[model samples]
Target: MSKGHDFLITVKAPGKLYIAGEYAVVETGYPAILVALNQFVTVTVEESNDYGTINSQQYKENSLYWKREGNNMVFDNRDNPFHYILSAVHLAESYAQSLNKTMKCYHLNIDSDLDSPDGKKYGLGSSAAVTVATVKALCRFYDLPITNDILFKLSAIAHLDIQGNGSLGDIAASVYGGWIAYRSFDREWLKKARNTFTLNKLISIEWPQLNIELLTPPENLELLIGWTGSPASTSHLVDAVGLEKAEKRSSYQEFLDLSKNCLFKMIDGFHNHSIEIIQKEIRINRELLQHLGKISNVEIETPLLQKLCETAENANGAAKTSGAGGGDCGIVVINKKYATSSLIKEWKKNGICPLNLHVHQIND
Candidate 1:
């Protein structure tokens, strides 16, 4: 293969799931710890005579092209993948400029493991990962003096532009790497705190560790199967909750309080290394999520997911939807004693595959 440029940069950004404190993170100013799953968005940037071209072999066969119009970059949205790529790169350039640096034009290839069906659930923040990866590639390509905080903030801005609303935690986790306690509700307070810690110092801080076992269906434990087939917009879901809050609904307040309690318990479980307690906390967390009305759609909790939850509960395993619910992946914490071959066979019979993800601290 002939090379197109002097340098090629590849960056991978991970997806995230909100284990606890989903709705509350936006309002109560609490920390949400999001796990970066193995699935990632990969970007390849190389110098080109063309202002920019984004190609995703997985999504589309043709390349999406963009040209620089003075200081602005423009793209055509007829091609969805290219539109997203162009938007991401433009944001990256803007981010570079904010750091008192310029971004050079390049041919960028953006790819993601976020395709429907085989891909992880739609709500796992794949778009955020792509934004982070694109920003990192632009930073590297231009040798811009962009810090992790800048990258995170820029990514959040891009996400808001792309999806209308997003939890900044996903972008923060991708840029900062590993586990992070992020609360962006009070930007002024956070902005002041950011001045006190350099990116290098922040990255060097030790994050708490917890043992995560990616369970093999049946051999490890029982799992629930749920598929709504209808894609749910995370922004719409959050908007619904926001309406409840604005209306002064007591249920909304109670759900927020429960989420806070769950967050505390989850943190305690992590700090104390108590798997049993963590499982209990997860159950409470799911219940609170359901009460918030985000998990109300029958499509969100598919018949399969409902069955799996019922089966898992009967088998001493707790199960719930992982992301925004509506037709995404489900999480199950099974008791080691009850994770038997019989349970595995039952799940396979229903076409529900279990992804056992192990949680470990990334020691830099």
Candidate 2:
């Protein structure tokens, strides 16, 4: 622990769902909307004597015993389930060292509620949440002077080093909380800058083309999320789409243009507090994703997901797949005047699990 503070520090980061702009958001400067849900990954860190242990409630069999050898973590076991957490530890410690802070061994305990009782993923961004929570917990443990922006940058670098692609929009939602309009930073510039700049200097500098704006939803708008009972791999879907990006030149560009326009309109609806315009744009964006799936020959919306959307639309709500969408959850935007009980019952009949999640906001 730092001096007199010999207590445990715990931090929680909420999981996220992509509301709009999934594939297009992967490109730099393109915008996307995401929400932080009540589901969270919590990390707790405590000072240890000499060696430390990394344990998780979800992965009890994969607990790790580690010790610091001059700021490097040397684990006793080779099999590690905490890849993103370890990355976050290294990045945050590196930043601390850049400020001439000493490193110490600490026991880290992780707990999560982002999955089902049987351990099936619900398509929420658990990895990003875990990384963000770990980073935040370390910041508290080390008593580092960090803002949300600095925390986001460090977490993003840690995540990007592992995932290598995709927008860090999930990280933004985890960091800032609530509904956010986010644009990705330039990956090419970051790739080079990581090699040239020091950790502290890089985090302090502004990232190119990155933007995040918190938004307030219309008073009448109601958000509903339904799980398809099947988990989808976002990276696999992204990689599959990447193969077609080069082949379908004009079609891909057209998809990007239309998605950009639709998301902009939806963002405007949030600003103007118009539920009608927002729902209309949601329908349009869903169609755009359908076309993209066709061109890419990928199953963006599976049969079950299609049924989930159709049921919500029949209930006078606009719906679509929340993320990569081959499986996982779908989101609905409806007017609060309408009751979702019957609609949710119908969803249950079709094997769709309606998640009782609310928007999570950071009160800072």
Per-candidate Cα lDDT values, in order, are 0.61, 0.93
Estimate, for each residue in 285-322, the C-alpha lDDT of model 2 and write its tens digit: 99999999999999999999999999999999999999
Q: TM-score for every candidate vs. truth?
A: 0.77, 0.98
Candidate 2, position 69, lDDT: 91
Separate clash counts for every candidate: 10, 0
How much does each candidate deviate from the true structure in C-alpha RMSD? 6.0, 1.2
RMSD of 2: 1.2
lDDT (tens digit, per residue) of candidate 1 on 192-212 = 544676433432333222112
Best by lDDT: 2
Off by over 4 Å in 2: 1-6
lDDT of 2: 0.93
Name the best candidate (by TM-score). 2
